[model samples]
Structures are given as C-alpha cells and as structure tokens.
Target: MEPNNEKSIGVQLTWPIKQSSRVPTPATPQAEDQKIEQGSSKKRKTSDIWNHFTKIKDGATTKAICLNCSATLSAQSNAGTNHLWRHYHRCKSEPRQSVLVPRNSQSLPELIRPPKFNQEAMQECLVEMIVAHQYPFSMVEHRSFREFISALQPKFKMIDQATLQTECMNLYKKRKAVISKQFDDHPSKIALTLEHWSSLDTSSFLKISAHYINPQWKLISRTIAFRLLPPPVDANVIVECITDVLEDWKLLNKCGSITAESSNSNDLAVNKICEMLKERQLLKSTDDYFHVRCAAGAMKEIVQEAFKTTQEAISKLRRIVHLVTATEASKASLQEVAGNCGLPSNKLPSRDILSRWDSTYSMISDALNFQLAFEYLQATQPEYLDCPTALEWLQLKTLKEALEVFHESVSSLSKTDLPSANRSYLNMKKIERHLSKPEHYENNHSINIICPMANAFQKYWARLREFSEIASVLDPRLKLQYLQFSLVKQHGVLVAGEKLTISKNRLICPTIPQLRV
Candidate 1:
C-alpha cells in the first residue's frame, strides 16, 4: 500500500518527461570545455606520436616540443593534435641535429650514439697485439693479461691459447699472401740479406730479409723467411735454404744480391750463388760480385779481436761493476757516493758479456762515467776494493773513447731503414781514420790500444765488398768524391785512383746484375 504512493510519485515524475514542457537545465560551457580538454589529453597520452615530444605549458598556451630537433609547436586541446603529428613526421624526415656546447654549458643535452660492441673486431685486435709484440701464444692464458682484457671489456670473450694460435697463423698466412703478391708485382729486383746464427740452445736459425725500393722510391726491408736451418749448414745447404726462400717468395728470378758473414761456408755459398746466377743468365757479366759481405759482422769481428788486447783492464772494470752491483747495499753505496761526488746517482755500471762488444762498450762508458764514485767507494768502503786505479781509469777512458767511435760506426751501419750496404764504405773509412790518427800512436799507452785496434781493423776490414763500394758511389750526395776520399784515406792517393779506375771499369763491364739501389 505504501509503495503505491511512491509509484504514483514516480509516475508523475515520468509524466513530466520534460522533452518539451520544461526548460532543460542549461549546460555549463566551462564544464563542457573541461570535458573536451580531458578527452583530448587522454587521446594525446594514448597516441604513439606523443612519445617523441614533451608537453609543457608556455604561460597559458600548451606546447609540444620535439626531443630530437628541440622544436616547439602548439599542443592546446582545441589546436587538434593533427598539426603536432604532422610536425613530428616532418622533423623526423631530416637528420637529427647535433649541438656542440661549451665546457661549462647548460644547454640542450648532447645526443651521443654509443659505438656498438663488435666481438669479432675485438678478437682481431687481440690477435694483432700478440703478433706485433712477439708474445707467445700462451700469453692468452696469463692471468694478469686476461684480467686486464676482461676489465677493459667484460663483453669480449677470452680466447684460449689454442684459438689465439690458430688466429695468429691465419693472420700470418693472410699477410704472407699479401706480401707475396706485392713482391710479384714489384718492378725492381730484390736484394736479400741472409743472417744465420745459432741460439744459446744450439738451435740454428736463418733469417732472410728482402730489400727493395717501392714504386714510390721508398726503401723497404722486410723479413721474408725465418725458419730452422737444419744440421750440416754448409755451402750447399745454405744455398738450398736461400733458394727455397726465394722461390717461396717468388723472388728467385728477382734476386739481386745475398749478403752474409765473411766465413768459409758463406764464401762458398756466395760462389755457388754466383755460379747459379750465371747459369740462369741472371748475371750481367762473369764475377762472384752478387755476394755482399756483412759489414756489421765484420765490424763485430774487429771489435772482438780488439777486445783481446784490453781483456786484463776489462776484467778489472768488470770486477768493479761486480763489486758495486753485487748487492743492494753495494748499489746504494755506489749511488750515495755518486750523489756526493756531484754525479747522477742513476749512472750505474753495466755488466759486459764476453761475446758482445757492444755490451763491453756500454760497460766501459758507464764505468768511466762513475769513476769518481768508484774511487770514493774504494776509499770509504773497506769491502769495495776493486776500484780501477787512476791510471787504469784513464786507460779505460781512452779505451771508451776509442771504442765509442767503433760503437757509433757499427750502430750507423747496422741501421735497416735503408740498405746498409751503401753506407759500409763510409763507416769503414771512419773507423780507419779514427784508428790511424797519428796522435793516437804518440803515447805508449795509446800505442798499446791503437796498435791492436788497427791490426784487428785491417784483418777484418781488409777487403771491402765491390758491391758496397759501388753502392756508395751510386749515392747522389756522395757519388765518386766520397768514395775517392774514403779510398785515399785508407790506400793513399795513388792506390785510391787505381781503385776508382777499377770500380768504374767494373761498373762499365757490368759484373753484377739486378743491382739494388
């Protein structure tokens, strides 16, 4: 019964269905605008184009900015996002701009694209490092080196020794092929320097290096072959090894000269090579002039022979070095003494190896530099009694001065940048002039040193290679004048003239073929 009134009221409310009878409540324009703005904002948040832009209020106006181009556009709800979308498409069509900023800048952030990691490129670099430094393959297994690499790039996987070795061999083969192609394409003949030496382990190795001027007229020296030289390293075996290398590098026909030590086996090998060149019609005339004697080896021989004369004094200096450097305390004492004597404490003595005259030169130079310190050590330290006497120190100074010339000359001739052959005569002449200085023979002590050096120089440098002589003359800077001057310094003016005449005749007759300039 109660519901019947409620129903009657609801029926009355329905009867007044204000479609036409009642004025409809007026809609608020502000509320409608707000609704529209909210709907548009929702639409913008959902649209994919809004991701490239950041929305912001510029005073009362809403704006949309492009992240890449930093462009601003209207973003009001009523402005319709269609323009914003159009601007985004157009801005993306052009390349993204890069803006440089000053050191203390507060500007648009820089957009930097980081380099992508390339595992293969990194591995190749590691393999190159191994090859370049002559690192053993097992270096990959070294804990510190591996840790260093891992710290450098955690993404780079470490290769095992076996894999590293495989990669290195592959690289070697690839580079060898490229070099072989270069040699094949080279227009000029290739001269070779052959070095055969035995290691401390008694294992002999032969290193064959090729020298030639490129098309650009630049001198290049590259080792073509380094391999084991098996037993019976005689003339035939040496020739066979060299032949194999030449053939392997496709340089057999292009072979111009072979330089080796002045030994019986090497001499015979040169003779055999000369005969072979003649047989192949590779020689321009009949002579064993294709062989160039190793000037460095000759220089070493002279120093070694000269070293015998000063062995007693050298032993004394060696003892001094041993006394000074025997222990840490001795070394400190020497340094203290050096510092007190107004000398550099770092200037310490160098040990001399019996077989290496270069080491001998270094030892003499260093010991001579520390002479005052050595005297102080002998005076203060009772245990340090091996200091060279004043006269002995003077003698060592003289010896160092004399050996310094040979040392410098040898170093100059040992350079591999250009052909050392061209410089052989000049260096030899330098040694001759230094030794035959008339002032050197004045004092008995000087005579004792100079006589042995001159004798050793004569014994080793007695016969200058014809090719070396010719090469010196070929130099534009020196030409015949330098050669004539050098020859006159050694063999007097008349003999020098005769030698020049012989050299000219030999060149005219063309005794050697494919001469490397």
Candidate 2:
C-alpha cells in the first residue's frame, strides 16, 4: 500500500509542472523549415524593411521596433513586415511623442543634426575666388557676387572685404612659411637676380628672384621678394634690402652669386654686399666670386653701342623693309618680283624694333635672304625711293655675318636653363677670333664697324675672363687647358705658368691633387 502511495505521488508530480521564468526558446525544426520556405518564396523581391524597423525577440514573439519612434510592434507572418511599414509612415506623417524611459533604465543620447548652412564649402569657394584669380578683396562685397553665393547656397553667409583681406594675408603667410622651409632645406647654392622696377605710378619695387639646381639636375626659378622700396634707393639701401631678404631666408652663406644690371649703384651695392659677407665671415676678403653683372644686359649695351657706328647703313636697310611692306599693293608687287626671282613668294621683309638689337639683326638676316627680290624691285621700279645701293647691300652682308656671331652668343648666354658661366670665357674668346679675321680688317667699311665692336667686346671680355676663368677651369669640357691657353694668349708663357701655379695653389691644389704638366 505504501508503494502505491509513492506511485500516486509521482503521478501528482508529473501532473503539476514546475513554474519557471519564461525565456525565448529556439524555434522548432519544422517552424524553421517553414520560415526558410517563406523566405525563399519572397526572395524574388528585394526588401528595404530593415531601414525603418529592427528585428527583436520578446519571449516567444518576434517583434519589430520602429527606429524613428522606438515603438514596439508584433510582426505577422501573413502580412510579413507590412505592419512595420505602415507604422513608420504614420510616425513620419504625424510627429509622435518621445518614448518615455523607466527611471532606472539607460537610453541612447539624441543625435545632433547639422546646420542648414555649409560654412566650410562656402569658405573654400571664397578662397578660390580671391587667391586663384587675384581678385580684389572688395570684390567679395560686390552685390552680384553676393547674389551668386546666395543662389548657390541660400543660407550661407557672405564674408566682408575686411574679412577677405585677412584671409588672403593668412593664406600668404602659410604659403611663405612653406617656401621658406623649402629654401632652408635646398642642397645647392641659391643664385639670385636682383632688379629695381618702377611702376606706372612711379612707385619703385625691388625684385629678387632665386635660381637653383634641383635634385633632378633641372634648373628652377622662383620670385622670393617683390617688396616696395622706400625713398632714396641708393647703394646702401639696396644692399640693406638685399641683405635683409637673404638673411630672412637664411641664405647668406648659401648664396652663389648676385646678378644685376650694370650700374654704378649696383656696382657699389655689390661691393657693400661683399663687405657684409666678409664681415659675417661667410666670404673671404679676397673672394670676388659672389658678384656678377647681368650678361644679357652687358651684351645689349655693347651691341647697341656698336650698331651706332653703322646707323646710316642700318637706316637704309630699315627704310627698304618699310617701303616693301608699306601697303598691300607694294606687297603684291614684291611678291610678283619674288616669284620672278625664284624666291619664296610669301616671304615678307621683317620689321625691326628700335630698342631690340636682336630684332635688327633678324631684319638684316631676312633681307639678305631676299636680296635678289629687292634688287629686282629696285631695277624695275624707279619710284622705290629707299632702295638699298650696292655698297649698302655689301655693308649689310658684312654686318649680318659679324652680328650673327654676337646674336648666337647672346642667345646661348641668355638661356635661363643652361650653365652659361662656364662657357662665358670661351664664348668671348670665340668672338674675339671672329673679329680678328683679316677680311674684317682689310675692308675699310668692315674695319670701321668691326674695330669699335671689337673694342667694346674686349672691355667686356677682360671682365668676363677675370671672373669666369675659374669657372671655365671647373668645366669638364674645358679644364685647365682652356685656362692655360687663355693666359698664354693674354700674358706670356712664363706668366701663364706662374698664374696657373697660383690658381692651382689657391683653387685646385687645396681640394684636389696637383695636376702634372
């Protein structure tokens, strides 16, 4: 009987299930299979239901929580997630109350929305307008510009002229800082070209441009200073200004040379700069390598002076070109004459610029190429008043040939990208040899023209050889041979040997082994 009571107790325990807290249980296999089948059936259509609602488990029920309002909703299998779509639409159309949280529960912080005006985009546009185009700062306050900005971005605030000026100055400072850092880090010596320019308003400005060889062996030029100069731009003022700029860039010791137009003030400025360098111990008292006159400018002055001797012949040639190209009728006549002379029909005589000697040289060269056409025109047309005479033509030919040498030298030395210093002495020597030709001296007209040019060239030649002999010696193509030959020509062989020995002792012997004779 007692065993029977135990069985009854077991039956009673089985009948009364133990009460436990409800937790979400995993779905049964069959339910999962049904869900998979339903999902597969709906896979043909893409779903965006996740954008507005998040899936969440509540005990045994699968629910979707609205992202906008935090409203909890049960998902129905028959309707799929359509109920959540409707709830989202309703919440968007009609603003819902913020979800209240329990006092002890934690909630996420609210998101902060961006302002309607995009300040950064507007500022960038402002900078581009002012800096890139060099637009005046007052242009920012222009009514049309303001309207344009408003049309582009209605809520963006427009900046004033004062504000734009400040921005420009700040931008300049930032750029200057970057350039200063580059100058400080450059590995090669910095060559500078200094010039004083007067504006139309009579305001003077000192321009300093930097030239250096980059790591890739390419020459680079940049304008480092274009500052307004105060009154009395004397040698001392020029020296002070240049020194301040060089010191500002920390380039005093790194300076290779300072080139300026040939002027007494510039010469004095060079002397002062050399003194300053010596005072700073950056250059020795005997170092004269840091000063160089502008080669192009020197050549221009020499050519201009030499051309003055042949003004009569050059004037006749210039008149001939002007007459031929005076009118369309004259041009047509010249063309017909050219065709008959077996010359190029379309080739017209070039006009020369009075200030540019190179242009004059080009005019002479071109007229010589069309000599037959000009001669034909002169023979047939008696009314051609400025026709060049035979002697004038001969003069033109000799002048063209002689000036060709000068033109080629100027062109080669004027190039900014090439190393012209090493070739300076060699070029001068070549020109000297060209002028010393017997034909140039035999003809009276040729001698009259060549003597003065030779004299002017010699003056500049001596100056160049003095400064550039060492540079020539340094060149791989023209080593000590060029220097010795130049010295032997200028001085005797005994003096040449003594000068070479001195040069070797001062320049090469200290840094390199002595060369064998």
Candidate 3:
C-alpha cells in the first residue's frame, strides 16, 4: 500500500514499466487485418470494455499500455515481433505477469443497445394473442394492431397475412381504448372520443366507424348514465359530421370498398372488436363503427317490446324470445330443493310458501321464452329439441346436489344462528323423515306431468313467433322472424309438421288462435 497522501494510491498502474516487458506475437496478413479491425473497435486497444465507437485501421501505429501491468506496447515492431521474442526468451528465466482478464461491452454504458422488449417474448405474446383472443394466426400479418407492434417487436422470422390483421386489430383496439378511457373518465361529457382519430386510414376507417353509426345504446352507456350526459357530444363536431354523411351517403359508403371476400375472414374479429369497445362505452356518436343502415324495415314489434323504430320491431322480438328459451334449456342451472340437510322439498311447505321461488320463476320464465324462441326458430326454420328425459334426470340430480349443499350449510350453522332453534330442529326432523319416504308418494316425478310437456314443439314455435315479433324493436339484429319464414312456409299458419316454413311476410301474434297448415 502507498501512503494516503494527496495522491493516495493502492495497487498502481502506469504507462511504462522499467523492467522487462512482453508483447503479443505478430500475425499473418489476414489475422493482422482482423486484429486491426478488432483493435479499431475499441477506444483504447488494451481497454477491458469492448466498444466499436470508432475503430483504428490496421496500418495505423496505435499504441497503449496494459492497464494491469503498466507495460507499453506498439502495434508495429516493438509490440509483437522484437518484444515478444525477448519475452519468450526471458520467460524461461523470469516469471510471467498475471493481470489480464476477459473484455466485455458492459464495461462501458454508452454503447448502442437492442430494445427493451424481448423479440422472442414479443413473438410468443403475439402467438398467444392469436390462440387466446379468438383471432386467426394469419391476422397477425395484416392487422396494424399486430403489424406495428410486430415491427416494433418482430415475434416471428417471416410475417405473413398476420401482419395485416395485426395492424387492423391494433389500430381498432388502441382507438377504442383511447375513446373508452376518455368517455369513461368524463361520462357526462358530450365530447366523445373520435372513432377515426384523424390518424386512422380512410379505408379501414369505414369498418372502425360502423359501431358509431348503428350504436348499441346499452354498450355505449348504461341507459341511466347515457341520459345524464350533456348535449352535443361535441355537438358541433359530431352533429356536423353526421349531417355531412347523412346528406351525402357517398361520404359514408366507403363500406363498399371492403369487398365480401375481405370481410369473410375478418367479420367475427371486427364484430367482436366493435362489441367490446361499445360494451365498455369507449365509442361516441358520429363514429359509425358498424355502418349499419337504419333498419327502416322494422316491424310492429317496435311498439310492444322495444322503444326503437317500428322498422326493427320484428328483429328485436326474435332476440327476446331466444333470451327466454335459453334459461329453460340451461340444464346446468335448474336446481331442486329435495332432501336438503334434513329437510325435504316435497314435505316442506317451502314450495307452497314460495319465498324465493318468484325470482327463480321469473328467471326461468324469461330464460325459457328466449331459449325456446331460439330453438323454435332454429327448428321450424332450420333444425332443433327438448333435451332427452335422461338429460332432465341429470339436471334433477344436479338440483338434488345443490339442495344437499344447502342442507350442509344449514346444518353447519350453530343452533344459536336459528331464530327458533326448537322449531327449526323439529322442521329438520320432519324433513328428514319425509325425504326418507318412498319417492313415488311425494310425487317428485309429478313435476314433469304438471309442466306443459305435451306440445313441446308446437309451444316452442308459438313462443318464438310471439317473442320475435314483440321484441324485434328491442334488438333489431334478431331478424330471426324474417329468416323464420324461410322455414315455416305459408302465412298466418302454425303446425309442428316436418320442414315447417313461414312465409317472409307472415306476422301472426302468438296470443292469436292457432292455424293449421
């Protein structure tokens, strides 16, 4: 150690050493050139850090000292040829220096580096997006959503059609996010986030703008929240744009530019993107995200079910009907209360008392209407079923299991938890006794008998027609009635025969008397 004076020092290094010095061996022309190139890449040839900031050429007589042993060496004669020979000769007599270590670029921080996001990681993420987000792998090339991100982070070696889809999807999602966050932040503000934020391409803008044109009110905002919003929604901006497009349909007719073939591959994707954006209330009016022409062909359903225009009446009705039927056929959800902890559904007055059954009934009824409508339209017009009795039995089993779970919950609770412990205890005892009795006496199977199972097909079809016509105004996309006639042929007639087809113009009310083919 050196004295801790003004120039305090430890193990020291200097430019030149007084004692013997050794140099590297000279190389052939090819090797020499490579050395020169390597030397040039470093600021100081003997530096530990690797850097290619500015390289010194092979012919240049660059000189530097080994920072380790303080030995000076020159590129020419003294370093390798003459000096190396001296070192080789002296090495047999004297000990060699042991200060050299491997060099790395990390030693210096100013070097140009690769991006932060991993290329391989980005590629894997994109692949996952295709598999997980219901997008096709081919979309990764075409959509800007994927394309730009990919360009920023090239996941694969060769980007194909996915590039286009990536671009398209990325742009839409970004735009939607921007709009969604903007509107969600200032929910009551009329100034909406523009669907085509001047930055979007005009060709793709058509698709992006479709939702703006034919907006789903529920998705845009909860009807209550939407109503609270202030006027104009950038009234000056949207009203002006809307006026411009409505006045000249050509301005918005760019939808024609997107050919059917182009849409086929991407329709599901587009619809989903639009739906997600709208559901989150990301888009504002005058955006025309879906470009849906007003359904002026709405039926009388608009009056009875939906508040929308009469033209959409028929379509909305079909949607409501399907909604009902879905609940009925959702075999997973239908439950039973029989043999709960020690309580029997049949023996207990619970069904007759019906405390919570109304909610369930309403739910089932609504679900049944929607569900059966979807089935009826599918069946009479297309092909459809009452699930087999075995399925019904399975559903019953599930109901039984649910009851058992409930009983377990009740039994698990302490007696102090009950309002009347003695009464509850007796009730539990009675329930256990009743459930233990034979199944036939309690008439558990009689439930099916009580239910109207005779005209399942006829009733299912009739319910569909009713709901489709009535709910058409509520959801115009449910033009199941229109397509229904394609199956149930002949006007104002109802029959359960095979291959039923209603005429296109048929509009029979479900409440009306049945008509035979």
Candidate 4:
C-alpha cells in the first residue's frame, strides 16, 4: 500500500482535536456582527425567559447570570454557547420568582401604582350611600366620612354639600324621566298610595307611590312623588298635587286605586281626584275607581287599643328590662344567670316603645322566654326590685300570644311586593276567628285582651265592604262564595243575598243563584 497524501489528509481531519487550556474569549465583535447579520436576515423574537438572564463581561471572559435565581454560567468556552442555552433551559424549568421566595426586597419592582379616581363611579357611590342609608347630603362633608373615603382611595376628590345637593336634584330628575317613560310604556293600570307627613317645622309633604303589574305579571312599585304641600292642606290642594304628578307621568287615565290612611282629609282628597278625573271624562264617577284604606293603619289601631288593656303588665316588664340592662354589671350578671339556665344569649328582655305595639309584643315575648333568668335574678339580686310577680308573667304570656296574631296579620298585609289587597279579606277573617272564640283563651286575662282587639277590628271590619270585600270577592281563590258566606255569617241570609246582588251589580257581573244559594 503506497502512501496517498489525499487519503492521509482526510484521515487526520477525521481525528478529534485536543481541548485548549486557554478558553476562547466570548466573541464580542463576532457575536455583535453575527447578531446584526442575523437581525437583517431574520426577525428578532422576544420572550419572558430572556429577561431573567443578563450578559456580563469580566475582563476578557463573558458569562450569563439569572436575575431571578442568581445562577451563573460561563458564556464563552471552547465547547461553544451550549452552556448558555443549557443554563437558560434549567433556569426556566425552575419555579417562577413569584412562586419562590419573594425577589430580594432591594431588587423587587413596584407591582401597583396609585389609581386615578373615576368621578362617575364615585358620584354613583355617593348617591347610593345617600339613598340606601337615608343619609343626609351633608354627610359627605362630615370630617369622619371624608377621612373614611380618603382611607379607601386617597386620590378621590369629595363633593361639597352644595355640589351634593345639585347632584341629588339632577339624579332625581334623571330618575323621574326614566319613570315617566316607564309609565307611558306600561300596559296596565297603576295603583297608588298617598301619605301625608308633617315635619317638626310644620312643613307638610305629600308622598305618592305607584304600583302596577308588568307584562311579565310581576308587581313593581316605586315612589313617584314627594312634593311639599303649601300651608292649609285641603282636599282641593291634595287633588291638585296628585293630578299634577299623575299628569306629569301621563298616568291620570291609567290610575286604578288610591290607598291612604283612613282620614277625613284623605277621603275627601280621593273623592275630589275622582271627581276631577270624571269631569275630564277619564273616569265615569268617584265609585268608578276604588279608594282603599291602609290595612297597616287599621291593624295599628287595633293593636294600639289592645295594648291599652295590658299596660300594667307591659309597664312591669319594661321596668324589669330597664333594670337588667341598666348597667354593664347588671347585663353581665344577667348573662351569667341566663347561661347557667341554658337560655339563649339573645333571650334578654327588650324594652318597648309605647307607640309601637310590635315592640311591646317583643318586650313581653322576650321576658317570657327568659322567665327563669328573671326569677333567678329576682331571688339573688337585691337591686332588681321591680321584678314581675308570677301572676304578672302569666299575663305577659297571654298578652304575647294574643298580640302574635295581630303582628302576623299586619306583616302579611304590609308586603308591598305581593298582591296584599286580594288577601286582605282572608287576613281579616283569620284575625276575627282568632278573637271571636273566648274558648281559645286560657284565662279571663286573655279574654279581656281579645275583647278590645275584636272591637277595634269590628269597627274596621264593617268598612271593608267599601273596597276590600270587593277585592276578596273578585279573587279566584275566594270568589263570590267567600263573600256570600262571610256576609251571611255576619248579616243573616236575607241581607247577605241582597248585599251580594248589589255588589254583583256594582261589579257588572251576572247574578248567579248558586252564589246566593
């Protein structure tokens, strides 16, 4: 085999080269030149992983350090840039900085900046706070309130009282425009509730709320007007005010019934409103539209009278509650006793507001629930001098039971979201049944409570025929049968039949003998 120079050179080229002791410096200029050339040839792609590694130059050596993990790797070597690629891949495989220990505080970047105040959103929040909480417009000017808002958002500029008032009026006007449009688009008749309130300054205001059924059969209610009534409020003045509101909303002809507290002035107002409507050919007569009494007002009257009968018992319970809650020490002692007897922590007695019968009932009921606690306190504590006697507690129990019926009745009729008018007669009937039978009472004390309540209800019951009875008779669940039965039970068969005939005629319904039979 003769030596061939071409074959020898090829064999030598195939042999591996020995590694150099002096590593090649990272090709700075070459790398820059290569990068520029590559940039021209191809579009540069950016990635988040590239942000963590920073290229560092030390004398002639070049290396990469991960900003997040602080891992260092040689960038220039005889083996080439494979170490830089491996280091980046390993650093990316490691957990993200946010998942690891927080980046060194000194090196951490600010994550959040102060936000600019959104005036519209802030204005809406202020309006909601005022409306929902019944806060005065000047509340925003309160130092404490301003400080609270500042704590929440330091950059927010709060409105002054004058600006707040202007915003309130603008909001009202905007809402009125929306509601007026709703009335115009509504397909059903609107029922209204009128209330007159007098302030301490003797300024009178007439509030009117509208209720109507939507196309979806949902009952919707909204307060439409709260207008100041000039001095000398009379039927004509009230009628004018109401008409203006109704006309403003284009609801004068669409009005159904107007409910107000049973008062001479309100009755006259309703009559006058109907008369004006009739003159305008909007209604046929005053009777064409119903003038209903407030069911809650009637119930309040009944409860008020019923409360008078148990005033002595209520007063004693009130004194006991007062003493129990008189001091921190007394409350603590009472809590201790209550806990010992396994009584609920909330079973502590409550004080009653003389004007509100429901509060009176709560006082008595709470006293009854914590009867053992009261007894224990009476025996042990010398300061609790006005504790109720055994007989007094029995009276309180009786009073509570009797008052519960009225409370429940009032609650049911006060549901503005539901059709309470249709159920008025049924609720009245339930109240009557509860009071009618003396056998339901365990003692004469309870009977005494029932008598006055029954009397108060009877007074209002007779007036139900004016409107509520008509609603009851029209209800599909009760129909004419309930009216006939109720009438006969109260006013005998002959009168019941005659009254039914008159009611049917008024309702423009055909007389059916079965209703009378």
Query: Which RMSD values do the candidates have, in order?
Result: 14.6, 14.8, 23.9, 12.0
Per-residue lDDT tens digits for candidate 2, residues 1-517, read: 0112312221121111112333222233334335445654554432344555677877778887766667888865554654554565457422322333233222333342223466866686687777899888888788998898789888788888777778778777877898887778886567788877887787889999888766776666778888888887788888888988998878897776788877888889988887887798776565555677676667776777668877887898898888888899988888888888888876687899885799999999888888888887777777665667888788788888888888998888777367456766767777777888888888788887788888887776666655566667767888888789888986899999999897776564331221100
Where does the lowest 10-residue lDDT sum fall in candidate 3? 293-302
RMSD of 1: 14.6
lDDT of each: 0.74, 0.72, 0.32, 0.72
Cα deviation of 8 in candidate 2 (Å)? Answer: 57
User: After superposing candidate 2, which stretches have Cα over 4 Å from the reference?
Assistant: 1-171, 186-189, 195-206, 213-220, 227-244, 247-256, 276-282, 323-330, 375-383, 485-499, 505-517
lDDT of 4 by residue, 1-517 (tens): 2223333221121111123333222223335335434655575432222344576898899876766468877756443444454454455444431243332443444663224469788887788679778888778889999999999888788999888888888888888889888878886567899988777798999999998767776778889889999979887789889989997888887786788877778889998887777788765453543577787777888887766877777777788888888888878888888899999876577677765678878878777878898888888877665787887787778777777887888777665458557777777787887887657566687777777888888887777644676677667888899888988997899999999898887666432211110
Give per-residue lDDT, candidate 4, residue 420: 54
Residue 447 lDDT (model 2): 84
Of 1 and 3, the candidate ahead on lDDT is 1
Report the lDDT tens digits of candidate 1 across residue range 1-517. 0112312221121111112344222123333334444753454223444556679998999998876578888888777555655564456432422222233333324564334589999999999988898988888888998899999899989999889879889988989998888888887778888787678988888888888888887887889888787886778888888878877877867887777878898889877877887788876555545777788888877766656767677888898787777889888878887888998877688788766789889989887778788777788777657666777777777788888887898777556467456788778778888888888878877777778778877766656657667877777888889878877977999999999899888777654445764
**Poorest lDDT segment (10 consecutive residues) of candidate 1:** 9-18
TM values, all candidates: 0.72, 0.63, 0.20, 0.65
Candidate 3 regions with alpha-carbon error over 4 angstroms: 1-517
Query: Which model is ahead, 1 or 2, in terms of lDDT?
Result: 1
Best by TM-score: 1
